[model samples]
Target chain A: MQLNESDLSWRSLPGTLPVRHAVVSREQLLLLCRDVAGRGARLVSLWGEDRRAAGVGYVLVVVLDLTSRLLLTESISRSPNPGFPDLSQLFPSAGRMQRATHDLLGFNFLGADARPWLRHSAWAKDAYPLRHDFVAAAVSAPPLPTEIYPFVRVEGDGAHEIAVGPVHAGTIEPGHFRFSVVGEKVLRLEQQLGYTHKGIEKRFEGLSVQQGSKLAARVSGDSAVAYAWAYAMAVESLTDTQVPARALALRALLLERERLANHLGDLGGIGNDAGLSFGLAQFSRLKEDLLRVNATVWGARYLFDEILPGGVATDLAPTALPILLDSLAAMAAEVAVLQDIYDNHAGLQDRFHGAGVLSAKLARQLGVVGLAARASGQAQDWRAALEIPPYDGFAIGSVLAEGGDVAARVAVRFDEIAESLQVCRGLLTDLPSGEISVAVGKTRADELAVGGIEGWRGPILVGLRVAADGRIARCHPHDPSWLNWPALEHAIIDNIVPDFPLINKSFNLSYSGQDL
Target chain B: MWKILKQIVRTGLVTEPAPNAEPRLLEHALHADIHRLFGRALCIRQVDAGSCNGCELEIHALSNAYYNLEGLGIKFVASPRHADALLVTGPVSKHMADALRRTYEATPEPKLVIAVGDCAACGGVFGEDSYAGLGRIANVIPVDVTVPGCPPTPTALLQGILAALQSPTSRVDKRSASTYQKTEDRG
Candidate 1:
């Protein structure tokens, strides 16, 4: 990979770019990231603004490495309107990221796939919401603006398109999916999301760093702990602040509990969808029991508003220690019973075995990550890979399965639950005695940092840029769903429409999370 | 038949509790009316206008063992016609306005509307967003109960449903409400 110390007239920070400088041209910047990406670097964040700096408008793109955790910045003048060479050709998943950049900012990624990732008719054709000139309080955009969106269609005698949701029968998130199907089998499934898009990124523009963290937590309620912790990590890194040992442990504990709760509920629900009510009953009970223990130990059942900037809101009580141990013991036993049932049940096995098979090759090609990826034999888990503090203290074993099917996903969850329970038990036994939180002092302005955590779903990454007055300049909480959502469409290809719920449940991609 | 019998035998005599499972004693306590309404069967139909899916997750979680609504007479019906109450979880999207109204209309009389989550209650964070206009369920339909939470836990949803069934201290005269104050529907 090539490295350059190209000069940028814009602001520069110590840890931002490797060389304490930025590339002047967008081409050089793109090439630098391209080189690093070619050498197997996962670009974490790409963001910029149309700033009137030095009497000129400029857009910057910052990319980071998944391995080194280093940041690189690229800037170009707005006059030439330079576009980054489409990294989508190099990384298929980059298509969405590049498309998002194109949509929000006016910057383009040349020769990228044509489909707009999030341009879901929410705005007019010419309107760019992320632009500096774009008014925040604009009530309406011009109506009936037509734009082309490409979806590969299958032509046959009796084939038709089935448009589902944006509004669905079941209580779920809104996302429009147009399915070209013949009979029960789906030929192609194209998704149109951003129906619940609340302009969270735009709203984060002027909030204080601490308040921005609260907003990050709400990006997706299910992964609130992950998002909050990520934001905290970013800010802490910016301030070069090291959180206390006890606070780190508490955060880790909460994170594990969050993962466990979500997994149990999802595992059970997937089973229920497959007509295995026994799994549903048992797993759901375990999940509920776990959440109750959480509410008693922590404040909330879903554990909302517990995680704050520097550390947690409240400390785990000395009285609650033994209770947590007992709850963990109960969870272990109950999970064992459910696993036994899942293992031996012929009907459940039949339904789960080969259904929704996502091959390992396809998973890699599609850049699928998280448990869904792990189930399909992609053994990368960010918590273990990144060697974050509490996780560093523990032996984090990566779970994998060769089957790449619904059964494999179930097996992965079962393994993860066991591991999480074990981790929780370990935490309880080795529970630290100290203050749960420390007061996070006022954040310095122009501070930018990146935070990442291995959430139950996958890596929850957040990038925070604080303005001069300690308000947020930009805050982007990237959910694992951004990488995993497309995998669902591919996984459902040959599967019948009747089993769509099962497949969808298995992945459980968050629409709000992705939209943010 | 044999399989069902064998399964029942294996599971050991599955039936509704003789003295009620003490609904409030479950980890997250249920409302008193819900405790009384336990095993008093009624079908529930859920409507989604535009939610973040948090409320839906809790609703799905309700079927699990700890606060199993099935143990009480509460059931999630597949069809609106079969339902006695409508459990709406969303901010009432402009696109879904028609479908939500139609579903409510399809439900039988003495129907209850239990708006689940902060989104359904007051649109929560998504309240002021462009797409999610008229944030609460009460804005669209006459809501009988509101369970305020970023997605209230399953127990809270149960409580809300129970609260809906209970007789209110002050009731609006229906004749006057239908004609004059139709615009002002209190949830």
Candidate 2:
């Protein structure tokens, strides 16, 4: 990708993925983002780090996904008042990240939304949790009189606001949604998240790389396998550790199992949300069957600690192969039968078709990545496309769907499930033989590495930095929900308030993943 | 239509045998006690006070045909007002601490508060109280039971719910359940 302005130095970061880095001035930062957006690159994640101890002041870093490679743009603010020019104008997803950076490190974005994003009046006004100098007492000062969030008022002939929680009706993480509506037709939707931010980023400091992986796996529990793999990849890259082939193959299997589990569960959840309790009953049973197999084969219903730094902690035994294969065979046939039921059932089809349509143009504009983007006809699956590890050796065809509605998302989920089943079967039969793990050597100080894995939801990227004392200096495990949550706000533009949960289940974005 | 029926009939009732959550616990005793105590029904309200949703996944599994929580007379409702038990997941995040407190307050009395994950029980890998959260469900409200696992399995979850129903200690708020706390002296 060509930059708008020439004559800039680029440093290639050492990793399995193709990533390049460059430091720029405030003026150049704006220019670079504008150029990246113009060239179809999207802002994957934007986070700030307090670097005052190293002579550098607050640093703003944004990971831009170039499809083939990742571009890291760093803007170091050295002045008394450290700030960077806002990139929200070029990328809509940049707005929330900018506000979050501001709240954590006390950085001012000249042209960004100044309202609080993650800081729900949890701490004092001058408290900057991410700053190098900040230290919290045993008891944090009582949150300032709950700061008023000024949701844009929509006044009209029959407009009314329906406020839903930080504590919702369902067994889901906390986040507030304010829907401006006329009766049931939604005029607009605004989300206030960050109710689950439990100091994960701050907690990363001083944790050994081993402990960091355990913590990262929990950042968003549903994607435990994916996050653990991403952390392992980052640590391996930083330490120049070469993971074994068997471990890599097993990791791919664990990740695919995770994908299969979530898709099966969400497909059921979507059906249940659409008033088909039968769908919930059948699909969830299949998911339960798969999970029992997971526990039997891998020793955990959820694959959390399986992927380690140098390799994987668990290995597949020859005897367990038949069990895994048999379960997949049964699930594949049952899923096809259910797909037929979903397709021909008039009532279910009516609800799924043309409900919550997010135009591909808008989805691309909003930088929506992963399955949601795929449903909207934005074909980008990093693992299969970029050929991540063992996946590069497999036969994986692209899975895409048009319409960007609940139906399309359902279609994509079914297609992804089918493909993942194939991938898992292939990995099992052609299972490689080697040591599952090895020791990760000493990590040099002040080194940073990036790991981007295409998690079931979307691309989950881990930006890990090694401290001078060989502990975690800073770790930003970003969830794709950051880019997709705003898209959900836009997707519900005119859908009925009642259809909100159904439409929402189709996306099923992670609240804790983003809140963290 | 036929496909749906056939799948349902083929799947059948895969719900495990009685006392599935923890096999050692006598199901006849707990099931009969539940029938007598709550009239063969227990309505629960699950709150994600702020742990990773690992616990919620297992909680959702409770409703599957394999667990058949509904058949056991336990149902997850939409509002805390209808709840007889509150299943709080995760270490209480600061932003969620207040909302969680309000949820506990809304649930009807003789209600049980069961912490569903290790984080909810005693602050998991993410650790305890800080600027961002008040670790563990007990930090925010009285905990009747702590179902501890990184994310407790569905079977463990069922046991936790049943244990809460049977334990006389659970009937009283943990603050006032001091009399039930046995002395170390064995007096």
DockQ for each model: 0.30, 0.64
DockQ agreement of candidate 1 with the native complex: 0.30
Chain B TM-score (each prediction, in order): 0.70, 0.84
lDDT of each: 0.71, 0.87
Steric clashes per prediction: 1, 1
TM-score of chain A of each: 0.91, 0.98
Choose the strongest candidate by lDDT: 2
Best candidate according to TM-score: 2
* Cand. 2 TM to true fold: 0.96
Score candidate 1 by TM-score against the native.
0.86
Candidate 1, after superposition: displacement of residue A269 in Å?
Answer: 1.2
By summed lDDT, the worst window of 10 consecutive residues in model 1 chain A runs over: A12-21
A1-516 in candidate 2: lDDT tens per residue? Answer: 345734568788776777888888778878788887888988899999988887877788888888888887778898756788888889999899988888888888997899888888677666788887887662456555567798988999999999999889898878999999998899999999988988899899889999999999999999998899889888988888888889999999999999999999999999999989999998999899999999999889998898989999888888899999999999999999999999998999999998999999999999999999999999998897667888898776489998999999999999999999999999999988989998999886776688888999999999888987889989999999999999999999889998999999999999889888
Instruction: Kindly report which residue stretches of model 1 are placed more than 4 angstroms away from their true locations once superposed.
Output: A1-24, A43-50, A53-65, A68-77, A80-82, A140-150, B1-42, B48-50, B78-84, B92-111, B127-134, B138-142, B168-187
- lDDT tens string, model 1, A100-188? 77666666777776566666555654566767677644423322333455767779987889988665656577777888889999888
